[model samples]
Target chain A: MTDNNSGFSDTKQEIMQATYDAIQQHGYAGLTIQSIADNFGKSKAALHYHYDTKEDILAAFLNYLLSEFRETIQIDEDSSPEQQLLDLVDVLLYGPDNSSSEEIFQMQTALLEIQSQSPHKQLYRDQFTQIYHWLGNLFVEIINNGIAENVFRDVNAHLTAQHLLLIIVGGILNRHTTNSEMSPDQIREIVTAQFLPYLKK
Target chain B: MTDNNSGFSDTKQEIMQATYDAIQQHGYAGLTIQSIADNFGKSKAALHYHYDTKEDILAAFLNYLLSEFRETIQIDEDSSPEQQLLDLVDVLLYGPDNSSSEEIFQMQTALLEIQSQSPHKQLYRDQFTQIYHWLGNLFVEIINNGIAENVFRDVNAHLTAQHLLLIIVGGILNRHTTNSEMSPDQIREIVTAQFLPYLKK
Candidate 1:
C-alpha cells in the first residue's frame, strides 16, 4: 500500500514538472497537451489517459502549484509574526531561492494569462478563489498573532490583511504587466518604510 | 482642412467604439478583426485598409482607451487634492457613472487578458507603460499638491504614489480575479479607514 501511494505521488510530480517545463518553453497561450507530453518524455496517449484536455492538465498544474506554494510559505513557529509576514511578501514577489528572478517572472506571466481566463473558466476561477482565500487567511493569522504578542498595534486584522493582499497583488501585476522598473528590494524597502510603520507598535 | 480633420477624428471614434463593442461581446481572447468589423457595421476590407492585422487595430484601440481614461479622470482644479485622489481611486475601481459594474468588470477582464499578453506584445506593453506612468504622475501631482497646501503630511510623494498605485492595481485584480465579496463600498471604506489615515495630517 505504501509503495502504491508513493508511486502515485511520483507520477503526479512528474506530470506537474512536465507541465511547468512546457509552459516555460511554449508559454500559456502556446502550450498544448502534446507539448506537455513532449516535456513529460512520454507518449501523448499517456498524458491523455490522465487529462482529457489541455485545461484539465493545466487545472491539475494549478493544484500542484498551490500545494507547492503552501509548502514554500509554511509558517515557522520560531519566527516572529512580523518576520513571517515579511517573508511571505518576499516569496510572493521574488519567489523561492531555488528559482531565478526571470523564471519567477515567466511563471507569473503565465499565471496571469490563466487568471485572465478565470472569468470564462470555472475550473480556473475555483483554483484562483482558493489561492486568494489562502493568502488572505495567512496574512490575517500573522497579523492576529502579532497583535496577540503585543508586537504590533491594535488594528483591524482583516482590513490590514486585505490591504496587504492588494498591495502584493498590485505589485505582481504591475511588475509583469508594465515591465515595472521597481526591483524586489526596492518594493520591500517601500513596504517597510511606507506601510509597516503604521502596523508596528 | 477643418472639415477633413473632423471627418478623420469621427472615423477614428467610430473604429474605437466598434472595437470596444467587439471586445465587450467576444472578449479579448475571442476577438478577431472580423468580429470588430462586424461591430463596426462596415466591411472587413474597410478595416483592413486602415490596419493590416488584428494586433494593429487592437493597438489603436488601446490608444483610444488611454485617451478615454485620461478624459474620464480629468483633474478638477476646484476640488481639494484629497478629493481628487479619492475620486481617482473611485474611478479606477468602479469606473465612470456611464458604465455599469458588469460592463466595467467585463472590460477589466478583457484588459487583464490583453495585459497578460503585454509581455509578448510590444504595442500592448508600450500602451500599458504609458497608462501606468500617466496614473502614477497623476497621483504624484495630487500628493504633492496636498503636501504644499498643508492638507497632507509631509511624505515622499513618489513612494506614496507607488503605494497607492499598487493598492489600486491590486484592488482591481482582486475584485475581478477572485470575484471578491468586498463590494465597492466595502473597498472604499477599507481604503478610507486603513490607508488614508497615513496620508492626512
Candidate 2:
C-alpha cells in the first residue's frame, strides 16, 4: 500500500511511525534499526532499502515533526487580538492536547535528542528561527492592537515579543528537562506579574 | 606527572582535554575516541587505555566541565549586592570572556548534544539541576537583599529566582543555537522591562 492517494509514500510513513515507536521504547541511544524494522514484522533489510543510516530516518522524522508544527501554528482569523495572543501562548507552552503529560515529556525529550544531532543543528536552527519569526510578527500585531484599544501601554513590541518568546521557550524547556508543565496558572501568573508591567500601569 | 598532585592523573586530564577539544572542533556527533586522540597527537590506543568507549570519555568530559562550571560560578564577596547580581547575569549569559563567540557557540552546542543523550540524561539532569538550584538560591539571597535595601520591591524571592534562572538558561541556549550573544543591552532591557515589575516600581 505505497499509497492509494497522498503526498508521501505510505511505506515511508509506516517506517517513520515504527522509528517513533522504537524511540519511545528504547530511548534515542538505545534504538536500533532492527527494532524499527521489527515493528512492522519486516526484515531489517526492509528498512535498509529505504534508509541508509540511523540519522537518515531520524532526519525524515524531524521533517515530519516540522510539518506538524507548521500546521498547528495557525489561529482562526476572526479571533480578537487578545484571544489570538493567548492562543499563541497556549500553543507554544502546551504540546497538543491529545498527548498525555508523560507522552509529551517523552516525545519532547526524544525531539531534543534529534535536535541536538551535530550535523543537523542548522536544520533545527532554521526551523526554530522560522517559528520565532512568525511568533514575533504575531506579537507585534497583537501589541499594536492592544495599544490602539488602550489595553496595553506603549511598548517596543518587537523587543517585548522577543522577551516573551524567551520565557515561552524556557517554559517549553522545562517540559523536556523535567516533566514540569507551564501550567495555565503559571502562564496566567507570569503574564500578570511579568507582562503586566509593560501592559498596564 | 600522574603523582605531581591532585586526585586525577595527568594522563586523565590529557584525555579529558582532548575530548573537550574534539567536541569544540567537531560537535558531539562527529567526535570519536580516535578524533579525541588526534587532538593531543596521541594514538587511539592511548584513549582506549583510559576510555573503553566514546560515552565513557564524554561522561568524564562532562564531570570536568561541571567542576570548571562550579569554580567560575562565584562572585567576589566584597561587591555590593547589585553588582553581584549583574555579575551573575553576565556569567550565565556571556560565558567566560576568553573564548571566542564561535568557540562558545560550538561548546554549548556540544553540551546540548551531551544533555540529550538518553542513557546519560539523568546524569546531565543532576548536574544541570545542581547548577540551577545553586543559581536559584543565590538569586533568592540577592533579591531578598535588594528588597531589604529598598532597591527592589517586595517579591517572592524563591519564585522570582526560579523565573530569572529559566531566562538565564534560555539565554544560554541562544549562544549555541545561533551564535547569539545575550548582550548587555538585551540583559539591561530585560531587567528593565521584565524584572523591574519585581524590582522597585
Candidate 3:
C-alpha cells in the first residue's frame, strides 16, 4: 500500500516538473494538456485526471512557488525591523538560485494571460491579492520596527511597503524585458546602493 | 502651389488625428483603413496617399510622440548630470497625456498580435530601438553627472541606468499586461520614491 501511494505521488511531482519545463521552453501560448501528456508519454485523459485543465496546472505551479518562497523566508518574530527588511531584500534579491529565468517568465506571461480570460481571471485575482497582502504586511512589520527603534521616519508604512514591492517587482520585470546585460550580482549591487541610502538610520 | 501644399498638409494631420481617435474607440482588432477614412469623411484612396498602409499610420503616430517628446524636453547641452536626470524623469513621467486607456489597449494588443508578423515587426522594431536608445542615453547622462558631482557611489553608472530604465519600462508593460486596478499615479509614486532616494546627496 505504501509503495503504491509513493509511486502515485512521484508521478504527480513528475507531471508538475514536466509542465514547468514545457512552459519554460514554449511559453504560455504553447502550453496544453496534450503537450504535457505527450511529454510524459501518457494519455490526455491521464493528464486530465491529474489536472482538470491548464488553469489547474497553473494554479498548482503558483501554489508551489508560494510555498517555496514561504520556505525561503524565515520571518523571526524577535528580529529588528532593519534586520527584517534586509532579510526581505536578501530573499528577493538573493534567495534560492534554483529559480530559473524561464520559469519566472513563463509564470508571469501565464498569469497575465489568465487575467484577461474570464472565470480564471477571478482565480488569478484572488491569488494576486493574497501575494500583495502578504508582501504589504511584511513591510508594515519592518516599518513599525524601524520607527520604534528611531531609525525610520514617521512616514506612512503602507505606502513605503507598497513602493518597495513595486521597486523589487519592477526591477525583475525590467530585467526580463530589456535583457539588461548586468549580471544578477551587479543588478543587486545597484539596487542596494540606490535604495539603502534612503534608509534613515 | 505653396498655399495648396499647406492645405494638404493640414488635411493629412486631420486624417491622422481621426485615425488615432478611431483606433482608440474601436480598438486595433476592429480598426480598419476604411473606418478611419469614414470617420473623417475622406476617401480610402486619400488616406492611402498619405499612409501606404495601416502599419504606416501606426508608425507615424509613434514618430509624432517621439518628436513631440524631443521638443517638450528643455535640453541643455551643459547641464549637470543630476539636473539632466531630473529633466529626463520629468519628460518620461509628465509628458502630455496623449494616451487614453482604450488607445493604449488597442495599440498594445495590435502590436502583440503582430509581434512576429513581417513588415509590421520591422516597423515596430525601428520605433522600439529609437525609444530604447533615447532611454539608455538618458541613463548614461545621469551616471556621468553623478561621477562628476561625486554624489553617487562609484558604481557602474551605465549598467545602473539601464537597470532603472528596465524597471520603468517593465512597470509600464505590467500595466498593459495585467490591467490591474493600479493607477498610473499609484505606480508613479512608488517608482519615484524608490528611484529618487538613490539620487539624493
State each model's C-alpha RMSD to the native: 3.1, 4.9, 6.6
Q: Please report, as a residue range, the 10-residue window in candidate 3 chain B with the lowest summed lDDT.
A: B111-120
- For each candidate, the alpha-carbon lDDT, in order, equals 0.83, 0.67, 0.60
Encode model 1's per-residue lDDT on B64-137: one tens digit a residue. 88788765678888999989999998998888977898888789888887887887898888888889998999
lDDT tens string, model 2, A40-88? 5799888899989887777677665555655656766687666777777
How much is the lDDT of residue B105 in candidate 1? Answer: 79
Lowest lDDT sum, 10 consecutive residues, model 1 chain B, at B1-10
Error of 3 at B201 (Å): 3.9
Give per-residue lDDT, candidate 3, residue A164: 62
Per-model TM values vs. the true structure: 0.93, 0.76, 0.65
Q: Write the per-residue lDDT of candidate 1 for residues A1-201, one digit (tens) a residue.
A: 112222237776888889999988888888988888898999999998888888888888887788777766788889998899998999988898788888887898899888878878878888888888889999999999999999999999988998888777787787777756666776776678777887899
The numbered model that scores best in DockQ is 1
List candidate 2 segments past 4 Å from native: A1-83, A118-121, A178-192, A196-201, B1-18, B34-57, B77-80, B118-120, B178-193, B196-198
Per residue, candidate 2 scores C-alpha lDDT tens digits across B88-159 of: 887665577676757766776777666666324565665555555666788889888888888777777766
Error of 2 at B126 (Å): 1.7
lDDT of 3 by residue, B1-201 (tens): 112222236676677667767766676557899889888788899888888998887767555545545555555668766567666754454443564555554555444333222212467556655656677776877777777788766666776676566555544444444425555566566546655555545
**CAPRI band of model 1?**
medium
